[model samples]
Target: MMVPDRVEIDAAGDAVLAADQAAALLGVALPAFLADLRAGVVFSIVERGEGADAGTLRLTLRRRGTERRLVVDAATGRVIAAEGG
Candidate 1:
């Protein structure tokens, strides 16, 4: 099993690289993602468990009272899983 590279988190607890990739995947700009983070949106980078998503960066985004989780490949920045809104 190959380990993914460590993702750096900013002081605001936002995973910088994962957020950038997620914003691009969502067709949004980096600024928009930052703005959302500033506006009390919840963002977190978690570790995926077993199966195909194992060892990936699981980015959970919660904004406007809606919650969504995006499973991203830390190495490739590919969105492997997206759930909720």
Candidate 2:
């Protein structure tokens, strides 16, 4: 007897948001961010929450000397919280 060559794992239906998409929801100028990034004056970080904060994405963008942070729901792509944006 031979086991199946492959097995499929099932995950509950959920909507996952991409980092770029999450950033777009903040209504910031992407072009400027790109420019600053190229000039090494801007940086970004994307993090996913766990446990009680599961299914959430935390995005932080820094440009010049300012920082913007946002918490988005992974399943619905909604901005849960925003600071300094």
Candidate 3:
């Protein structure tokens, strides 16, 4: 799959906020977050549940062959969930 450029993702407004929140939760800087996003990270916007207008941003990152996922609430910029470290 083709990963989006930072500018393209940032253009959506909420994407950048979600990325920033996820990065902060992981204790990383914005540049590092963007770099990771560029380096085969998987990102998507998903609805919280049925009837939920706002969605969460899901990010999957791999490091040293270990993959982890972070779910960030787009409306509040909060990390709602994390998996696999």
Identify the leading candidate in terms of TM-score: 2
C-alpha lDDT of all candidate models, in order: 0.56, 0.56, 0.52
Residue pairs clashing, model 2: none
- Model 3 misplaced stretches (Cα beyond 4 Å): 1-11, 14-54
Q: How high is each candidate's TM-score? A: 0.46, 0.59, 0.42
Worst 10 residues of 3 by lDDT: 1-10
Which residue pairs come into collision in candidate 3?
A: none
lDDT of 2 by residue, 1-85 (tens): 1111121212542333333443353444667656655788766676778999997777676666677676767666566777774
Per-residue lDDT of model 1, residues 46-83, tens digit only: 65446865656676655555555666565655556677
After TM-score superposition, what is the CA distance of residue 51 in candidate 1 from its true location, in Å?
A: 7.2
